[model samples]
Structure formats: C-alpha cells, structure tokens
Target: MIRIGKSVIVLVLLLLAARPHVYAQATDVVALTPTDDLLTALRIESSLSVFIDSLHHRTVRDIQVMPFSPVGRAVPNAGYTSEQARANPIWLRFRVQNATNKPIPLFVRVNFWCFESLQLFVTQTPEKTSAQTGSEALIRLLPPRVSRAVSTTAVDSLPGLLAASPVVGWRTPVAARPVHNRHFFFPVTVPAGADYTVYLRTLKVRGAQVVPVSLLRQAAYETWMQRDYLFWGGVLMTLLFVSLMSFFFFITTRDPIYWTYLLCVICLIGFMVINNGFLNQFAPSVQFWLPRQNCYFLFPLLLFYSNLVFVRTFLPLKKTPLRWLHRLSAGVLLAGLFCVLMLVVENWVQLSSPVEMAFLRLFTLFYWLPMPVMAAYVVMSLYRRYYRSAAWLYLVAITPFYILNFGQVVANFGLIPTYRPLVNFDIYAATGLFEVLALTFGLAYRYKLMRDNSDRLLSSQREQERTTFATEVQTLAQKNSLLEERERIARDLHDNVGAQLAFMITSLLHIGRQVEQQPIVNGKIQAEQLRTIVGYARDAIRTLRETIWAIQQERFTLAEFEERLNQYVNRYVQQTNGLDVVVEVEGDSGQPLTSAQVLNLFRIVQEALSNVVQHARATEATVRLQTQPNGTFCLTIQDNGQGLNFSPDDADNGERHYGISNMKRRTEELGASFRIYANAGTVVEARREAEMAN
Candidate 1:
C-alpha cells in the first residue's frame, strides 16, 4: 500500500510537469473572435480614393464612398411650396475603400451635406437653371488626380423641395469640433442650382490601420475579455488540480506538507486572479473597491506564497536560517495581504490612478523577489547534497517564470511601451506554463528520490542474503564435525568392548571343558566349579548383550532392526533350555523406514524381550511382526507360561524395572505406542506408526 501511494503521487507530479511543454508545443493562441465592422465600413467607401496607414505603416488604396441615405424621388407640393423650399432634405453617403495594393476590401461612412444646418437632402432631382436655360445642375466627378473633374447634369433642386414636404433645420453649427485629437466627422453641402463636385485622391496609409477606430476598440475589448477568461480559467484549474493533489497526497501519505501546499496554491491562485482583473468580470461590483494599482504587489505576493510552499516541500529547510527564510517569505506575503486589505478598505481611492497602482505593484514585486532567490538557494543547497539533477530541474522550472514575471513587473511599472501585449506574451499566460513546468520538476525530483531509495533497499536485501548464506554454511560445517565425532566414538566402543567380551567368552568355554574332563575329588568342589563357570558365562553373555544392543541402537537401519530382533529371540532359546522362542515376520520386505524410526522400534523390541526374559520366566515365547490395515507395523511378544503376579502399579511406580519404561519411552519417541500386560503370561506390544502420505 505504501508503494502504491508513492507511485500515484509520482505519476501525478510527472503528468503536471510534462503538461506545459506539451501544451506549448501544440499552439499558443487561446481564442479568436472575428468582426465585420471594418469590412462594412470599407464597402461603403468604394467610390472614394483614400489611403490608410496601419500601425505597421503599410499603405492601402482605392477607397470608395457610398451614400448613407439614398436620394428620395421628387414629390408634389403637400404644403406651402415656397415655405418647403426654405427647408432642405438630408441625405448621407458611405464610401468603400480598397487600401491594400492587392485590392483589400473596406467599408467607410461619409456624411453628406453634414455642415449645412438646413434640412438634410432626402432626394436627388434634375432641374434647369434660369441662367443656362436648358442646362441642369452638373454632377461633378474627379479622376485619380486631386484636381481633375467631370460634370453630369444630375441634380439642381432644393433638397427640401425634392422631397414632398419641407424639413426642419437646426440653427446649430454645421460641423462638430474634433475631440481628443480625433477628427470624428465628415461634412459636405450642395447648394441649389450648383454643380456638386466630388474629388477623390489616394493618400499614403497603412492598410491594416484601415480598420475603423470603433472596430479597434471592439477588438481590444474582446481581447481583454478573452484574457480574462483564460487567466481565471487557468487559475481555477490550477487551484482545482492543486487541491486534488493535496487531498490525494494527504490521504495516501498522511503528509502535512501537501495540505499546506494546497492551501498556499489556493491563496496564490486567488491572489493572481484578483490581481489580473479576471475576478472583475465575475464580481464587477468589487471592481470599484479593488485597487488595480496594487496588482503589481498582489502578483509578487502570490508568487512568494506559491514558491515558498514549493521550496519548503522540495527542500524541507526546517532548521536554522533557511527555515527563517520561509518565515520571512510568509511575512512578506502577509504584508502584501495587509496592503490588499488597506486598498480594499480605502475603496481604491487611496491608489487614485494607474500611476499609484503601478507604484504599489512595483513595491509588491520587491516583496516577491525573495521567493525566487530563496528557491535558488534551495536548489543550490540540494546540489551540494548530491541532488544535482533535482537542483537542475528546479532551476529550469523556475527560470521561465522568473523571467516572464519579471517582465510583467517591469511592464507594471510602465517601463514597457505596451502593457497588454507584453502581459499576454510574457506574464499572464506564461506564468501558467511556468507553473506546470515547476510541478513537473517537482515530480522528477520525487522520482529520483524513489529510485535512490529503491536502489538502497535492493543493496540492503542483497547484503542480508549474503549474511544468511554465510550463517547457513557455518551451521552445516558444525553439524559435519559433530557427525564425525559420533562415528569415531561408535567405532571405538565396538572395537574395545566387543573384542574383550569375545575373549572372555572363549576362555570360559575352555575352562568349562577342562573342568568337565578333570576328575573331581569331592562333589561339593565339582559343584562349586560348575557354579563358577555358569556365573562366568552369564556375566559374559550380559556384557555381550549390552554391547550389541548399544552398538545396534546407535546406527540401526531397517535390515539391522529385523536381524537384531531374530538374534535376541535365538539367544533367549539358547539361554532358557526348556523354553522355545519362535519369531515370525510379515509385510513387504522391500519397504523401508527412516533410521530414527527403525532405531526407536528396535530398542522398543529389545526392551520388551528383555522384560520377558527376566520377568516372564515362561515356558514358551512367540514374537510376531505384522503390518496392520491402518498402514502401521505392529510387533507383539507373548509368552505362554505362568502369568506374572505384578500389578499395574508396579509399572507406574518404577518398581517393575527399567526395561518396560525404556520400551515405552522409545516407542513414544518414534511417535508410536507401547502396550504391556500379563495375560496368561507377559505380553509386550510395540507398534510403529506409518508415515503420512504427502
């Protein structure tokens, strides 16, 4: 479970780290909006020859003009005709322009007779002038030349008279004065019975600037809106991701750092969104209170908080001055928060203007500057600890953000010419990318730590294996030495005891034969000689039996077990002259038992027979070995003679003898059972339990 959690955290970190470079490679544009105002304006100016210059100084040509209002048809007098003539009808024209060399399309607005306070012209009418008799009002036209003109007897009537009813006129000035260094009006008036001349000429202008001023304003508004969406959207996503990661890490690892970092990320994301004007859209009422001027400070404070958390987690400088640095960062961020609170409470009146806002923002930048420096310090510290790769990753992650954020800082202070463009390219969007990169670096460092730990664990495991192997080897060597010593002792016992016992037996046999051949002076002396020989023979037999039993028990095998039992029975027959001992064996002869079990069973059988020989004193004895149906081998020694008068208490009280006790103990040692009783005579039974099937 521990391993699984680490893997998940590492995976999430890796994904976050790789997200920035992957997204950057795909595309830079966040959104695009299309507008037709410029096109509509250009189409209206088709008849005019105008040149427009764009911001890049490119020229556009062949501007045309179209009427804003079409000329109305002449109508019969509906009221006092002469009074109607005093009023003038109004008409408007629009111009279309092709400002680019390659014939770009344009739309323009051209106000007609705008300077005249008389009624606007509603129609175009043809009428002969009294001075020219048959000649009508000429419609003058100009060629590409500035002064060239042509005439058409197109219109010469009062603009008001041309329409059915007279129109009212304003007693105000014919032209509006330009405001804010922009000429916002175009005015033209045609007199009654006069040739109306329209001149067209090309001007040196950039085609791109041919876009109407209104359209430019609209574009900027849309761009600002898009930036708002992207900035806040990114901040929200980052907050959510950080929150989720925090919860995950906390739950999985029970780590406090992840939760702290999550809190810091949320605060930082909030600060950034508010500082960037993103929050303004959603909470427009707060805009009046939010100090736009303090954005500079807010942004750096956010960075300070975010980077401080990152450094504390990544480097864990918990002791000494390094720890104090984290505390200092937090203090700075708190100071920034206090500044924000002051600004909010002051209703933004304290900042007063963009300049004041910019100054405060610059001040905030200074506060945040320490975070990156501290990050660098952390990276350097890690490098010194042989975490060079992790340090490099940290450096790479932070560098882009540092440079871009610094650019923003500069732009905020009005050090840059254009604010929005620089902010778009350098700060707002770039910060998101940088954050993702930094997260990736963090993941990489974690992975390196995991790899190093795994390597260490593997090394430790290998060392443990080596130690275990050496211990096992030493144990085996000790066991081998013990076995050798036991074998030497067994050989010595067999050689010394067996040889001495055999020699004594031979001398006793010879002495018995010599005594039998010798003449006896008295019956008592011969009797004494006979008793001495018998005693010598009994002592030798006992010694030989003890030696054989001891030797056989030490290294008894399956075959030796059967042979020893047969020898014991034969010896009993020879010793008890009137007693008959019969032995029978059954079951698979090829079947084998382990040496320990065989030795145990052999000792059990020897003890049982010894008990019968010493205590039963029966006339006949029968020993039967048989395999039972339960897969166990059973041995029964029975004597048909005078039943022993011993009680069961004798066996329990250690009064009966050691022989029965030894039999019981040996059988138990082999995980078998021993049974002894005196039914008709003495009966001792030992059974060897079979090995369990695998």
Candidate 2:
C-alpha cells in the first residue's frame, strides 16, 4: 500500500510540471459607472477576456465569429505562459456595461508595443439582451459564432483585407498610435444605458519579457504615462551620471578597472533602454529595428561580460571558483556575438526561424544561472576580509540586482513560473540604477587610496634625492680641505729642508776654506764646524718628522698632542747646548682637535721655544699646558732670560721679528689667539677654544 501511494505521488508531480501554469482563466462581463475614473484589468473578473488563435494566421472576421472561451487568462493575474506562447497570436475581447448618463468612451490598452500587427474590432451599437440596433458607430456588430469552413480566398475578393475595424498597432507606425506611446491603446466607446463588446487583435505579440495591460480614462492614461516615464527617466539620469563619472576617472588615472566599469554601465543602459520599450517608442524605426532583429542580445551579453571583467580586475579571483564563472561568462559573450553575426547574415541565408531565435535568446540564461550561486561564495569570502572595503561596497551595491537576476534566470529557464511583479524588467531598472550609483562612490574611494599611495612614493623619492645631494657636497668639501692641508705641509717641508740645507752648505763651505788656508790648525777647529753642521741637520730632521706625523692623522686628541709635544721638546733641549727645559701640564681634559689645530699649535710652541733660545738668551725654559673653562687649551712657554720687547714696528721690519710673526700667524691659523708679554720671564701664550657643537 505504501509503495502504491509513493508511485501515485510521483506520477502527479510529473503531470503538474508538464502542464501550462495558468490561473483566473474565466472571462465575465464588467460593469462601468461614472464614478469609476480609472481601473486595471488585473483585479476585475471580466477584464481578462482573451482568445487565442491556435493557428496564428487568421483574419479578424474569423476570430470574431470563432468561439472565445469566456474563460480567458489575463497577463499578471494568470500564472505564466500557456500553450499559446510564441507560436500563436491572441485576441482580447471583453464586454462593458455603460451605466452613465452619456456615452462612455473607454480606452482598451495593451501596455507593450512590440507586436507586428494590432487591430481593434467592436460592435457598432450596444446590444440589448440578445439584440440592439444603432447604425452610428464606425464598426459593425460581431457574430456570436464563426464557421470553420469560411474560405479566406473568398473574403479577400471583398472590398477590404481586414473585413473589420481599421488596423492600427505597429502595422500603423509608432508615431500614428491613438495615444502615440510606448504601449498600444485602442479606444472603445459604449453607449450609455447599454452593453457593447470590444476586441483587440495582435500578431507575433510575445516580448522578451512579460507585458502588462491596463484600462483607464484618457486623462488617467496620460497621467499614468507621465509618472512611469518620470520614474524610468530618473533611473536613466542616475546611470548616465555614473557613466560620465567613471569615464572622467578613467581619463584621469587611466585605470583599466574604471574603463571596464564605464563600459559595463554603458552597455547596461543600452540594454535597459531597449528592454524597457523606451527605444521602441522613440528611436527611428529603421535604425532601431536592425539591432532587435539581428543583434538583440548584444548589449545584455556585453553587460555581463564587462561586469565579469570588472570583478576579475578589481578583486582577487585567482585560485577560486569565481574564476570559472568568469570563463563561462566569456563563452556566453562570444556565443552571443556569433549569434548576432549569424542574424546579420539572415538576409541572405535562412539559417533559422523567428521561433528558433526566441529560443536561443532565452537559452543563453543557462550560462548565467550558476553565476548567482558562485556570487554567494564571492560575497561571503570578501565579507570576511573587511580590508577590501571597495569590493565589499561593490557587492553590497549589486546584491539586490543579483537577487532579481536569480529570479529572472530561473524564470527564463522555466525552472520557476514567472509573474509580472517578479519577472518584469522595471524592477531590474531600479536595481541597476542603485548598483551604478553605489559603485561610483566605491570607485571614488578606491581612486583616493591609489592617489595617496602614489603621492607618498613620490615624496619619498624626492627626499632620497635631497639626501644624496647633501652627501655629495660634504664629500667635495672634505676633498678640498685635504688638498689645502697637503699644500701647507709642502710649504713646511720647504722651510725646514730647503732653507736649512742652503744655510748649512754655505757655512760648511766657509769652514772648509778656513781649514784649507790654515793647514795646521788645531783639531778642535775642524771638529767644531763639523758638529755645527750636524746640529742644523738634526733640527731639520726633527721638524720634518713632526710634519709627517701631523699630516698622517685626520684628528688628534689633547692627550696625544701633549705627549707628542713633550717628546719633541726633550729632543730639542738635548740638541741645544746644555739648555734646560721643564714641561708641566695642569689639565687633562680629553678634548678632540682637528689635525690642522694640532699641527699649527705644535708649530707655535716650536717657534716660541726657538725665540727663547735665539732671542731671549735664556738658560732654562718652562713649557706649561693648562685647560681653561669651556674647552679652551692654553699653552705657555716662559724663559728665565733677559726679557725681549715686542713692537709692531719691529714685526714689519724686514726679517727682524720673522719668528714672532710666524708664531702669531700659526696661532691665528688655529682660529685662536697668541700673546707675548713679560712676566718675571718672557711668556708666549697661545689659546684655542673649542667650537660650538651642532
């Protein structure tokens, strides 16, 4: 028993899937009154009266006489498509009772205008219970029944092809519609206090999307159109703004992401404009017809393709499932383009029929169905990383459209039944506007971050260049200072070696002449002259050694300077005939001095000692080193000899006080001071103060 019940349930489920989903299929008479200004056919019982000519090639007269199943399915109120979707055309017929004091003029409107033909047929007079007579209206009364054997060839021999009211719809140009709108409106006037029947004829009428029909007063129809246009127009403006803004950014930064984003929006706008029926109403017929006829899927296919490119460029899709989605979208794009090429060639070759074209257009949705499922993974993956705030905003902006798009895809594939509210393109339009506008803000933020990073890199490069320039300047300055110091050392060598050698050679020559003339002088005379020459040679060697040492070092500490000074003075005292010198250092501050400072300071001490021996005629000399406050070094050389007087006039005298001037000049070279004054003995003091620290 259980197995039988399960099998029966399975059979029932298969039957339901195989059947056409339709609802509210019965048509009834609608009563009209003066108080009713506007109404939609969706909610009323009788407004849904429609008949399908299963064989699409039928005349208006044949349809009027054929039995219209009073049970007719309305567009939105009905579930979805029925057995008569693309292959057959439908005729809509409804009865309305005019209960007003005057004849009621009603407009029967079909809200889409893509049909190849639309004709209006109505009874000329209101029927009273089974019969009524009035010869006033333009149309004749329709018969209750049509003969199946009525010959179409016999009817063509008559006066008109229609054999009914004048045809109007796309057969009449869009500009010549009764209301001249995006929708088809046919006027129906019912005489007061009577009933009349109306019919709207359509051929090749199905659209890519569902179409809505409404019945309203003339004023109400115009007002309703204004509101609809206003809403869609605002959406257009928002999308246009996004396109312009992204294009401007692409120009400024030349980022391919922005360029792709602009392309996506442009394609979206084009697709939506055509899909919304705005282009059908406003565009020139020849210019507009070719695209829908040939490359109908171009804009929408390009839209999804560009969107995939934008996602790949702006986000890291590598090593993920979304990468496959990108590839699939690419395939769809190429297929759609190829399909367009084939359509363009249809003028020469009958590659496919209109029915096949419709099927192919809808079948492309199979490629896009997996996109929403994959998008869920991408959104959740991106959400976990709050750092990618830009991509997150992009996903947030498109989330609504993704939901609607999922519904659209499922409906197109017949996996779910379509309803006007769920499957209409108008909802897509609103969400599309929201997506582009929000993505614009995200693009701006992303650009700002890129620009800031660029600026920081540029600033760091400039700072590095400045530092390099400063280092180069410092190196050049040091080279110049070294060259100057080498030149000073050469001059010192000249003074010690060249001048002393010349004087020694002259004195030796005179001693040799004296020895030669005397011939029998004591051994003491020859020996004394030889010893004098040796003393001069030793002094030259000592001076040469000090210059060499100072030149080798770049810097000298105070302790090293003091120790070297002491060694030199001891050697000098031994060379001088029995001259006694005492060296005393009072301070031991570990101060650093430049090589030039020590060299020049040591030379000043040497000059002062020479004066003590040569000019002061002193037997004993004292060399004292003292550290003054604030990093100053004071060197004093005093002798207990008859004091010598200092005179500026003597300094200028030719070579009279050359040693005095040399000491002063050397002290000045150290950027210090030199003083010569008599205390109980003659004192020569040179003071050097340290420079301020940076």
Q: Deviation in angstroms for 191 in model 2?
A: 7.6
lDDT of 1 by residue, 389-416 (tens): 4455555555545554554444333333
Model 2 steric clash pairs: 25-72, 26-71, 65-146
User: How high is the lDDT of residue 270 in model 2?
Assistant: 88
lDDT of 1 at 420: 29
Candidate 1 at residue 92, lDDT? 25
Candidate 1 residue-wise lDDT at 669: 56
Local distance difference test scores for all models: 0.44, 0.64
Error of 1 at 324 (Å): 7.6
Q: Each prediction's TM-score against the native?
A: 0.42, 0.70
